[model samples]
Target chain A: MTISTMRLTGVAAACAIFSINAFAEDSSLTNPAISAVLDGYYQSAERPMSERVEGFGLGHTEVAMSANIDDMFYGKLTAVIEMHDGETELGLEEAFIQTLAMPYGLSMRAGRFLSDIGYLNNQHVHTDAFSDRPAAYRAFLGSHYFDDGVRLSYVAPTDLYWTMGVEAFKGDNMRAADEHNERDYKSTGVYTAFTKIGGDAGINGSWQAGLSYLRNENGRMTAEEHDHVAVLDEHDHEHSHSAQYTGENTYVADFVYKWAPNGNYKYQHLTLSGEFFRVTDFKPLEEEHDEHDAHDDEGKDYQDGWYLSSVYQFSPHWSAGLRYGQVDTQMMHDDHFDPQKLKETEVSLAWHQSHFSTVRLQYTNQQGTNFDGIEDDNVITLQYIMTLGAHGAHQF
Target chain B: MRINSKQFLPKALKTLTLAVTLGFISNAQAEFNIFACEPEYAALAKELAPDARIYSATTAMQDPHQVQARPSLIAKMRQADLAICAGADLEIGWLPMLQMKSANAKVRSTDQGLFFAAEQIDTVDQMKSVDRSMGDVHAKGNPHLHFDPKRLLGVAEALTQKLMQLDPDSTAQYQANLARFSQRWNDAIPRWEQKAKPLNGKKIIAYHSSFKYLFNWLGLEQVADLEPKPGIPPSSSHLASLLTRAKQGDILAIIIASYQSERGADWLGERADLPVIVLPMSVGGNEQSVDLFSLYDSAIDLLLAAK
Candidate 1:
């Protein structure tokens, strides 16, 4: 067995050298740059959430390849691999082609991609300072809103940085769950427009602020638990019924400010960012048997949320952050159902071993009031993120 | 429809006026714009073109290997007529992203407007084979060729040709500028050689391979590296081993670039009873190193002071 193992190892070494020589000769100029990110976590939570797992689990592991297809176009493809309920699942995260050279500072992108609606939505999960996204993002955007889309953006030729963009998407991926199976949409279902402006405060500081609007042609179905009360049947058994709401429009405003002494991120830095989101143009869709129909006539149905976070790297390897997020929902204007609210606070400490690797420990507390009554839970998670191969540079 | 027409008319007039004003400004100042990745190249372009507007993406106080692809830099690249950089994977981290993001044809690698300075000169330490375990080695060779005065002259000639090709109307001017600059550079080389004669064959420790070209030019030897590996910072274990090596009486002082952290070098210097010399690695690295000529002068002066 030992002799065979040595022979195998010898063969492997020879092949490796041969491949390296081949790669050096001409492969790099023709082959796409390949990269992969591995994320894993161990968490202990009093109550399980959509993203928080109880024990050891994979988190957002992905492999990506990108290259300029020609003089005019660049392409990238990213695939995600994860375990869901003891089953391995493979999915395409993004596959997009972007224009390399367009006239008048205009660029276009087409394919399945993350929407450029908010500051953190377009960035991958591994790039996040904290282990989990803010509560508002989870509730409103399902953590991130990615779908098949085409986008056209224009960068202004000005001293101060400014860009404007518009996008249209199939929107099947971004739609909310329909519990009653009452809604359907075909063709292009989502459209978005956004504008961002940024400038450097000095050599040590820079900031960007943006406002975005999303219009969903097909509205979403949501439960209105505030107004409906439980009714007792003839057998003296309690039955619960709630009104339904359909929401359409969303607006997001985000801002970020970063400061690094002498513009060097290697040693120390601070990042402060916040986002506000609102869902409007919502109305009552169904009320079971018309008993709660009075709530349908009421207007001004809306939902809004906001989050603020700050991460400070005091040393080269260590960083700590705190985030607070709150989301409120008023599906109906009537007082029969109280407004539902969810709030979460999180604190995390990360050890960045290098630019490509990080280990983080996070603590989270969630408190909220809904039809399920007041909820309070605490969670602790230990996570690691590592990247390998030719990774692309991160954007500011 | 009437209200829309009124809004459109005003917007159209404002855009037309802005366009006309911008056109006038650009035409009045028709000098070529160059974006250099490092300060040394920026200074060189200024010497060669004299009239061209130039922007340096990084200063001496910053590391060129890893730079934030900031939006302002993208804006600068979008307006650039030519982009020049030390391109033997030295800018592998950020420059490609800048090229793609700027969506500028002139700055793309495949275009004639983007120039790689390292390609113009045969560099030292060209590796036949490499790996990441070897600590960020470039297969093409060392990209810090600007430190070698002889190679830099060759680069100046190539850049003069490139400038002429891009701006044909100024061919005669560029030729004159190169002749004058080369003459002055040729005269200064021997003076620098005389000043640095005593420093030949000296051995010193450094943070990274950033000074290999400079050492090669000056005939100095690198004794040990402060970093445990290429691109990695010096750890306690590595420093402890270096402490024993520093006691061997022949080793000179520890040298580091201006942008490097002083902690590791200072610790070694304190324990080993050696001087920690901070050399200005590029143009504008120090007040005295305002340009290329003074940059070398300042570096040699600091090394001599340490000796």
Candidate 2:
């Protein structure tokens, strides 16, 4: 048997054991075991890849599990084991505990987690509708980027609805506490709630705005600043590259609107949504001396980007969409860098085969602000989807 | 105590409070702003809210699995009193985003605006396998319950109950409408059963497992699926297998949906001299199937004509 098949077989046995254990312990577990087994089969690595199927992607592997310990508290632990040439690779992906049945729509979560930015950020391997995510996500959001943090979410009641959330985390790094004591950093973020108003006014939407702050320390660089007394009459100075990767502040906001007159009209299926994100990292510079003994101080460079997308469905099964997206990686295209901006325009068309399934095709063209020429890319995809078990809310 | 008594001295204030309370109660019965995330619920909404404007972002012609983060749909959901959809991974990609962006407090989880199809309909194609060989698949059995009219009736009932609760003042109207619909539907069941009796026990091949419910309704034997698995399309090898099966008289004709590639079906039909019937799974799927009732009528007529 293949390694993946063996793994699934073992997991199936383990699930059987878990089901047996549940039945042995509490009759109230219900049919969750069946559901678990079904979800597990898709997430497991035993599935093969071929042309006729959604070819299992390359460089993707995950092992994560979450459990509800009691009524109020729940915990999740996941380790993404990377495979390079069939060898064991270590990576800590997601580990956290959350309050499940929190009071009054207020919930608390803490531990390592994948950051939420665009759609498909929090989903696992098996649950994804398509085999891959969109371009904006792969470029802006780090592939498999997760940080240790705590999150607070609250839902306020009103026709003008409200949902507030905040999170604090250790910047982006895989280092543990013992590995780099001086590299400790902190990042904080706050988000305004989503509000709704006016009934059947042909305009109903949800919007969120956020601000963030981050900082880091490097004692080694601070020590390098101390000039030691030189024995020689002339101080022949040695040089070391200062640690440039420190901390930075960021701000982000996203809004979406779903308006249908009377909420049940055949023509009320129009929708519009967009997201904007900006991050500015503080740049500390060094002084350079020329042969003439003149010194020059370096300037700082930061990065930012935003995208706007819209889609309109004429009916329940057919729709056309367009997205004009551009990113000014100010960090990459700053004064120190060559390019000044990077922008892309993409268009998409989708067809819903059934309530449980859909297929989409997208095309994109890109150009650089710094005259780096241009490149055009085309992507065609067909997806088949099915859903069962517990259903969640519709993200408008 | 003296200060509190003085605050309540205005008799006009009491009258205003009573009027406002009565007005609020009346407004509570105005109507419900419901968003059916899937098109299947759109039919039921038509019956439950005949006067209420009904809309679906998706229609009968496309797949529902891969809707992107559409902004226009989100606008409707923000004002929607309730959001209903087929659970399972049907709308996983689009729905999650809709939830995060829908500003409507009522449509969010606590308000129970998220109504699940499997919760209301009798489901089928539930896999008993734990093996990945079964393919990267759905855990919630099969979510395609809408192909069956019985499931449609269940949705109608669920919609009625929900609408009555949301618009209590219109409870009598909604109940009366539901009774009429149910009675007509029940009365038509015998005719449908009689029409389908002639096609019973007929061996047929389907493009995918898309017609399981349809087959069950007609009492037809599902000899094989065009796709090797439930969702996967038929491969060249699988097509060869079908040819082998067809030659042995194990299968009669190949059934397929209009949206799917008919090349495979045509190829098989050409080789076996078996007739290919392009069946419409939903209203407006074909020129002849323009409405909910005609959708099934076209299906029954086509199947009967084939015999």
Candidate 3:
């Protein structure tokens, strides 16, 4: 057998063994709930599969197992299988143990988990309203920020919902600096603080707003660097050169307003949400080598982006939404590279077949300034998402 | 001289206000907080602790299977001295998160402050083996046990004991309230039974298994369910078969809760010339379903009206 195929088999076997062990251990007294979600899409873009921003592809199939370990703790593990660079890959998406009974309204969580930065960052892709991530999220947060970390959150004792949280990560996020493979990155990685407040606006309306700040001491390009190189290849040919970055800070503010006409969501309802982000002081580290001459005089990089989306549930089973997103980046001083702006507008129609299944059709128009100058891309995606077993309901 | 009198009047008003505020503060201190996962439990808590602050996470118009986690729910759960829920997985979707977020020691599952009504009674429709094809079936059995009046009384009795355990000072008040509630409930059950005598052995269709306890109590036979499975939407083919069966048999009505979709029931009702009845599955489902007693009254009244 091929080496890749053998590796896939090994990973699959390991996942099976782990899941069986968990079930056997928990099911004796209290059975751990098992759930799986399958997502697929038929997508077409104006450009070729390799050159286009979108293409027909198989999305990830996720398997999740979760249960309470004891009275004071709960454990969850989710694994995903998907194609990565023409090779089948299996990865652990989340594995965490959270405290159920903590003092002073405080809860602690440890393990690899998604960051609670913006409204949609904590939600899975399959549960999102659109087929693709928003342009702001893609450019600012690298689509979604998942990290190995520890978090502590405190819900305040107030009439309105108020929560404050802090997270420390291993600095392995692709958007963060992790240049030295031999270095102990967790000690000097990413740290985040966030606060959220929400309350009912009136009889039928409810709203929530949150602000988050994240600091990455040293940011290094990992796999996403390859995509940047690919974009650069469209203009000038630059041979394999590695760049190190330092002092990256990001700020995000998000808000959501929902009106369900007297708290009844079965019929007509409207949800409007928006998020804005800004990143600053991400500069390439200066090295002693002459090969780094190209970026020696360049100033720090700055980026800002925002997205707004609204969904209207016209009926019990049917809903439609529209989103507008834009990202602007101020690049280093260079002749071939200039400050670029990208914008995307998307419209989607979805049908909730049941609580466990959904079918969606989305159309997106992307207009942006890339390495090759101005470009426009139109994409259409028809997607289906189905869930089996038990999946927890999403937070508002 | 008039200005001096006006200033004196202002001081008098301030003193009165402070006295009233203190009185309210003492009254609130004496009261306990109760957070119920569903409206039926909130209504039951009213009978046992009429003066306790009550909060219901979900209303009758909302689906009990799932709910959005709101800030108010967390705040209520955090302050609750007693947390009562119809917990055969009825509030499984949001309750765990709410409990964790609340971080209130009293309401933890292991604590006596946490009470599950389903644990106090026997449940039906429990699956020996569970699968997705069964469509969101609860492995712990149907959690809609409030429809059975007897089970509700049993749950109330247990809840009263829990309240007494938590607040010994209120023991006498809780017992008195329980006695009054038990008398009224016992008296009302027979009247409801007499009114529902014609519904015995009546064949009916339901949108979901939500009415299982109700059917068991009324001796109504659920001939077929509109949904293909527990949570799955009814397919056209299944609706077609139901239509044929409705025409062939003596079907009373197509019954559905206020929160459920009526498309399948309406389609079957239109073709078969049978009435589609929207019943108040719990309290506050409609105007007439103002409380637990009226919830049953409204449901039975709807059924009898359909006939």
- The candidates score, on chain A by TM-score, as follows 0.82, 0.58, 0.81
Top candidate on DockQ is 1
lDDT, model 2, position B37? 63
Q: Candidate 3: lDDT of B98?
A: 79
lDDT of residue B292 for candidate 3:
92
How accurate locally is residue A111 in candidate 1, as Cα lDDT from 0 to 100?
Answer: 95
lDDT tens per residue, model 3, B16-125: 99988986787577468889988999999998999998988778877777576666788778778889998888777778777866777679863668999988888887
Task: Kindly list the per-residue Cα lDDT of model 3 for residues A1-396, writing each as its tens digit.
Answer: 111122366466457756655664564535677777878777776321121134655575778888888888888888776654455556676899988778778888899788888888887877788876676676555456667889999888666888889998865533343333444444547899998888778757778899999888655322222223332332122111111112378889999988886566656678899999887665443322226345432333567789999999887568899999887764433222246677889999999866778899999887877523447877798888888767566467
B46-137, model 2: which lDDT tens digit per residue? Answer: 76677765557565544455354344565566556677787755676577566544444465552356677777765786655433446435
Q: What is the interface RMSD of each candidate, in Å?
A: 1.7, 8.7, 2.2
Badly placed stretches (over 4 Å) of model 3 are A1-30, A45-56, A174-186, A219-247, A266-269, A284-301, A313-317, A333-337, A371-374, B1-30
Over the stretch A242-302, how does candidate 2's per-residue lDDT look in tens digits? 1111224444455555554324222225555555645444332331111322212223344
Candidate 1, residues B65-141, lDDT tens digits: the string is 76777777877787788999988878888898788667777778524789999999898889877655666567889
Instruction: Give candidate 1's error at residue A120 in angstroms.
Output: 1.6
CA displacement after TM-score superposition, residue B102 of candidate 3 (Å) = 3.1
Candidate 1 on A258-374: residue-level lDDT in tens?
888777666678889999998876543553333644544243457788999999988767899999988876533333334677788999999976667899999988887761343
All candidates' lDDT scores?
0.77, 0.52, 0.75
lDDT score for residue A44 of model 2: 18
